[model samples]
Target chain A: MSFLAQSAAANPWFSWAYLRTNADTIRALVVEHLSFTVEAVAAAVVIGVPLAVLAYWVRPLSGPILASAGVLYTIPSLALFAFIAPFLGTGRLTVLIGLVLYALLLIIRSTLTGLSQVPPDVREAASAMGYGRLARLLRVELPLALPGLVTGVRLATVSTVALVTVGVLVGKGGLGQLIIGGFRNNFYKAEIATGAVLCVALAVLLDLLLAGFGRLVTPWRRERA
Target chain B: MNSFNQMINWLNDPLNWTNPDGIVTRLLEHLRLSFGAVLLACLVAWPIGIALGRRGRGGGLVVVLSNATQAIPVVALLTILPLTALGFGARPVIVALAVFAVPPLLATAYTGMREVDPDVRDAARGMGLSRWQLLRGVELPLAVPYLAAGLRTATVQVIATAALAALVNGGGLGMIVSAGFGIGIAAGGGQILAGGLLIAGLALLAEALLAWVQRRVTPAARQT
Candidate 1:
């Protein structure tokens, strides 16, 4: 039997030959996965922060805003993608929109909670120091809320990475394509393992990088720690 | 709009309910899988979390681990597991979902146990309550809301991810959606939309029900 046929029969979990042959495909998939994740999360933050600000500014809106996000979050990843694919035509945009919706609840809740946690006295101090509301929010509240916001970003980023794999159902599932493809390709164990491992590693690596970024931005936290 | 009407018409068809691969069967299968996974996860995570919480240690690790597990794509796990000797069935789906569920359940249980007010605990201890009495009477009651919240999160997550079971030859509502996809978009768009709608509706219903339960269980002081 040829190596491919032999490996298919044996179904080994690790095959150097498979990796060597599929290296370019795997690299492209990984890049696709990373880009999808980064873009989705960045978009979610852009949209989520303003919504969080709106919720914070208008106390009545908070309930509706958070509740809507919660509802969106409850929708299954597959269903969310399915719902949008008809309109978006089953590719990057559909996946991106679904991911942003999923990430919103986490980001909004964290940002709002972080902003709320900023002490009233500190706000008064900022105001007393001749700061306007926007200035206070930017200089005092946001600075103080950095840890929580960063934590939310990390959570959103990680979850987005996982959900991006669901895009495979629509032909945009980055590493997810490899995972499902391996399964359909005669239970190719090495391919499935490689895809799964890379996804998890990517999640962990990005989370750590975000954590580092969080620490770097909030130098005062370092001193306290 | 045309697709929406078709979806409505598809949902209304009597045969769709009574057929072998009908909505009712798929729904029941989905519910069964979700319930089993969540139950198994609770069994595995609750005891360990409670023990750690009571000790007031390992909470940080539990939190970190829980957050880390959020990164694990359920689809990947579902597909990867059946490749083992488990081999293409509900068994691997259940096992994968259970693993997916452990983190939130475990983390919440730990937090619930740890969040009991220290002063209340001290008062209970001073009143000559044994460790057992303290746990049962004081800590557990206070922890109910947190446990409920954790249960809610786990159930919702499991239900959503359980849809992927169809990919592994595991029975669930996912099979409906997958079947719809198999027929191609032009002919099967209505079926696809219907399946997606059903799954989304089921998940939302579960979320609302659990949120109500969480509210009911919470101490009145903590209702907000």
Candidate 2:
């Protein structure tokens, strides 16, 4: 094994040769990584937005709701996966659940913050203009809260991207599998570097995409800027 | 239920506590690595953070850079480092953990320092306090809560990520979980469950302890 590793070390760390041959594998991994991230963040938004709305409506529930989400975020990824794998099985489904759980706090907190920070006068004016409570929340509050919501989504998305690699421990690590494969294959630098680079690149790309989405949605803010 | 009972039995086992690779030894290793990483991160990040916060400039750049680092996976870093000159040992793991730890430490320290009330700072200046005196006497005290909060965040994150050390020949509770993985889950599932519980429990305990410290350090007026 040592001899093999020594020989592998002789291979260049950044090789077009490796890239060309492994292009298909890298593409598949990137797709898996992207899909997992999108699915997890989407699920988190679907679940978290309602919870945040509930917390916003019921003042007392906010504390417990956010606190519990915080607890979920605090659990180490590996431990969380291990704990859940028995019940959920070590697969994409388990990883998806874990990702969503980790993302809940960030999404909820940001959305709650965004909702709370809406100008009271704006809300009053909305009411005066015959907007009901639900209408005010849906039209006036949610739109104004777009920046904060976007920030939360960006944060959660980036974090989830990083975390998906940990899923490799359960055979669902997306790009993480390549990283581990590299390790077991005598520290194949090209494979490890590719996986790591792609992961970071994915994060940056998603963050920028979210930022663009935020700007695209908040046109009035753009004029001010 | 069976697995939970198995985990409990595993924890209760005397051999798991006293043997060479027992829980106690792994726990110590985890704590030591976590401490070293956080300390190193503090040493590297605090001075830069404090200076920037004091001057109240360059902080936006610092924040952006730190935020960028968040996207880099810890597991990837842990794996990559061992392939370098660092080789397989606690050093690479410590280095990776410290790197992961720096962003929170730096961000919080800068924010803590930057958040010092200008009025208080002006009063200190009016009293003819030197810059260093103002920082030590007024700013640092006021920033304690932020610093403590940052420390807590960094420490918890370090402790959590330190479990990845097992991937690179580093000693820690992760070794147990990975060991369980080495055998199949049917036979070694108890060890995996036990390891997860222990790791999560330790992280939560550290978080709670540090939160208490944060509360204590916060001034009465800022208690909320």
Candidate 3:
């Protein structure tokens, strides 16, 4: 008992000290998560936006494509990881595939809604000005749809950050490692504190960034008021 | 020829249905966990969601909390929660899954309430309904459709995430997939595939059931 008390006294704030000492790990984890999220969200936008555009143009296939993506969204993250592991191997590639698929539903739906919400009059005016389909979409439609698209991107970023934590299970790196390591070692303060800090920090940072992005993209929102 | 016939016979075997630990039993366990998590999430999030929706604008704090809680990965949340507590098992798994369900529920509820037309709210107030009465009679009914949509999303997500509970020694069909991966059985691939298929089927069933409920509960005038 004396020895235990001595040990506790010797390192009264051991967990905090340990976390501070491993600040490099925490920084690395944050960097890694942010990079992965950006990559995945970017890939999702590239693929999902085109698919959404195609679905909209094709009309008939939109329902089926959206439905399929919705169903894909229902696959548990771990299960999807497991399913993809056979083909992609259990590393960054597998994690990337899962994140991309997860983002697809949100991004695609957003793109479709954004594009469709462009006023018919705007499109007609663009056509009357002799603008082609591509020109109209680039100038008239996309700008109008920017708010909704940004909203989707913001949501997708949140999802990506959350889901990236799952990559820890397959030996990909993140703050998840700290949380998982802390748990395995039966260190309550360390585990909960680390998880709580990372979660809260990431959420606040992302929300602020997205809100700023929204404000930038939707000047009309400010002008209207 | 004999091996091929045996394989066919194995596929055709009735023993598949009557096995001591049958597929149906595993499915029931999965459903129980999924439903339990959803219920817990609804219990925790509904009041907060309703309040946030009614108040509007100031709900950013709740949204932040919900999003942060959600961003804590299921495996991490399950693993970490139990460390602070004792006897890590299904309880932690359920808590983590419930946390996962909360955000969508809250977001949906808040959006639903906020989306209630201001004109309608003004009319309700003009009719001399108290705030609570207006909420109960007008806002809630209108918000129900959106709430249902959010719940539907939550249900599907919860079911999917519940499969991960097996990682924390909370057995479900995920056990089959995990175990199959452990042994690396080419034959065990079938079990993993089967488990995946089962989850997909359950998700579809849940979606259909929720859609039906949404349609049934929503007033015909507001069907659009």
lDDT to native, each model = 0.88, 0.88, 0.75
| Per-residue accuracy of model 1 over A152-204 as CA lDDT, tens digit each | 99999999898888888787899999898888887788888899899999999
The model with the greatest DockQ is 2
Error of 2 at B78 (Å): 0.5
Residue-wise lDDT of candidate 2 within B17-65, one digit each (tens)?
8899999999999999999999999999999999998888988878787
**Model 3 TM:** 0.80
Better of 1 and 3 by TM-score: 1
Model 1, position A36: C-alpha lDDT score: 91
Better of 2 and 3 by TM-score: 2
What are the per-residue Cα lDDT tens digits for candidate 3 across A1-225?
674564445532136766777788878878877788889999999999889888867899899999999878877777777666654555788888889999999999998999898888988999999999888878888888888788888888877787887775466746666665665454444544675568547856886798898898789888987
Worst 10 residues of 1 chain B by lDDT: B180-189
List residue ranges in candidate 1 displaced over 4 A. Answer: A1-4, B116-139
Compare the candidates by TM-score and give the number of the best one: 2
For candidate 2, the lDDT comes to: 0.88
Whichever of 2 and 3 has more DockQ, that candidate is 2
User: Comparing chain B with the reference, what is the TM-score for each candidate?
Assistant: 0.94, 0.95, 0.84
lDDT of 3: 0.75
